[model samples]
Target: MVLPAPRYRKPANDLRPALPPAQRSGYTSALASPGPFTEMEKLLAVTAIGPDRAGLVRDLSEVVTRSGCSIHESRMMALGSEFAMLMLVGGNWHAIGKLRERAAELQEATGLTITLRDASARPKVDAVPYLVDVVTLDHEGIVLGLSEFFASRGLEIAEMSTRRYNAPHTGAIMFSVQMTVNVPASVHMASLREEFFAYCDAENLDAVLEPAQR
Candidate 1:
């Protein structure tokens, strides 16, 4: 799949909704073909959520390692009191079932909801022509708030990275976020910018939206 560059940053609309095991669609690695494999190899998308606290990070890393999975990429964040994790894991295609089962176990132990999906079959990414940067203080309702704002305006957040900023002793909770979004041709950039600023102003958050340089 062709991933949209940073210019088109939109939330994946095609992402399958999370469902319970009995209702799940079953284990199928979108990353693998039917061809007989001499070696097992598949890509899996794993998601986890939990209350923000120490050692949660270590527990997650250990889970992936113990499952015989190799981490390809990871993006995570602490949304207010809750922590979210997204990981791209590579392992034998035949082991997908075991991985899923283990993932469920991990979720149970961590007391965090988790899900697994075939990253290869992920929703098609849309390409746009802009970059979005958001900086705000860490607080409850930030992720949902931002997602709602973008959704209301018909924007897609393609890729986002956020982290807390602080000095060693001080330990501040300020956050800086950068996202790429897909901008439709029909959208008015100027008006969107105005509305975005107004929205940020209301929330006391700092934002910058601009056209991406090719």
Candidate 2:
């Protein structure tokens, strides 16, 4: 007797792995399909200095735009006859590579000495922010001394700005500094304040240390 024809069974779809209920719905379209994957955004710290001139910013910005990078933050200033700039640029890996490729051209066109550094995001820190202000007669080693003081205590200086000017009435030249420091949570606030005040007094610096106004 002839055997009955064997039945045809559809093959199982084993291309995709078995996923839990939560991930099953999107498993085919989101994971199985071929699609473009996103690249991690990167950062570059750019610094440039050159003779001050008109349209310098416009020229530099044009270069950045052409390279598909965006300036996240920047500080530009004129020091004497020279212009200096510091910028934090953000872009994808390919965009950053494009910027690097155009660096030489940018430098030649802008007449500026440019430097690019890879700046990765810093890990979050558990600390409190404090602002410190110091003013005193213009003299040497003021910044050095203050830096050493904070360094010795394991403090981080987030930002600082200093300048010199003549007193309004006395016309005496004076130096002033403003800084934001990160104080670790483990440090005793009262003790730190006392020590900071004592150090300021010994250095003849009229100072104030207070919590940073958010």
Candidate 3:
């Protein structure tokens, strides 16, 4: 007797079941259409310093716009008589290249010292955020002391700003500090605060350590 023809079978890896006629057409169309495509962004850290002048921001912004780059985050301030800018810009690779090429022109036209460097996105931190505010008589090593205190505890200072100004009534030169620190989740909040306050007391720094509000 003739042997029966071998039965047809799909390969084990072919797990997807066959679709109906209309469904098959739709599925094929979906596969053919390009889904959402997002271009990978390149980052650049741009810093510029120049004499305080009107239209400085305008000029810098114009260059970025023309280069097809956008400033993602920026800090612009007048430090004494000089204007300083720090920016995190994002764009495509070509856009970033264009921006880099224009840096010299921007420096020459705006009288600013410009610097650019490739930057990566900030990594997420698994820690609690606390705000530290300190006001004391202006003296040497205030920041150094505060930084050392946190550093010893393995805390990270995410952002910090310090300023010196004359007291409104007494005309005394006073220093003020504001900082956002990342405290590890494993740290005991009460103990840390107590130690920080004690240290502040010993150093004559009037300080407030509190949880940062979102």
In model 2, the clashing pairs are: none
**lDDT of candidate 3 at residue 14, scale 0 to 100:** 32
The lDDT leader among the candidates is: 3
lDDT of 3 by residue, 1-214 (tens): 1122222222223322232454222222111122222349888889999999999999898889999999876767899999998887888999999998888898987689999988877655556666677777789999999999999999988777677876665677778776778776678777777788788879987776766544
Worst 10 residues of 1 by lDDT: 23-32
lDDT against the true structure, per candidate, is: 0.63, 0.71, 0.73
Candidate 3's displacement at residue 52, Å, is: 0.8
- lDDT (Cα, tens digit) per residue for candidate 1, span 44-146: 8888898998987688777777777777667667899999988877777656667787778878877988889885524433334455666665787777787
Candidate 2: TM-score?
A: 0.78
Query: Which of the two, 2 or 3, has more lDDT?
Result: 3
List clashing residue pairs in candidate 3.
Answer: none
The numbered model that scores best in TM-score is: 3
Candidate 2 per-residue lDDT over residues 75-135, each given as its tens digit: 6778889999888788898999998878768898768998999986555566666767677
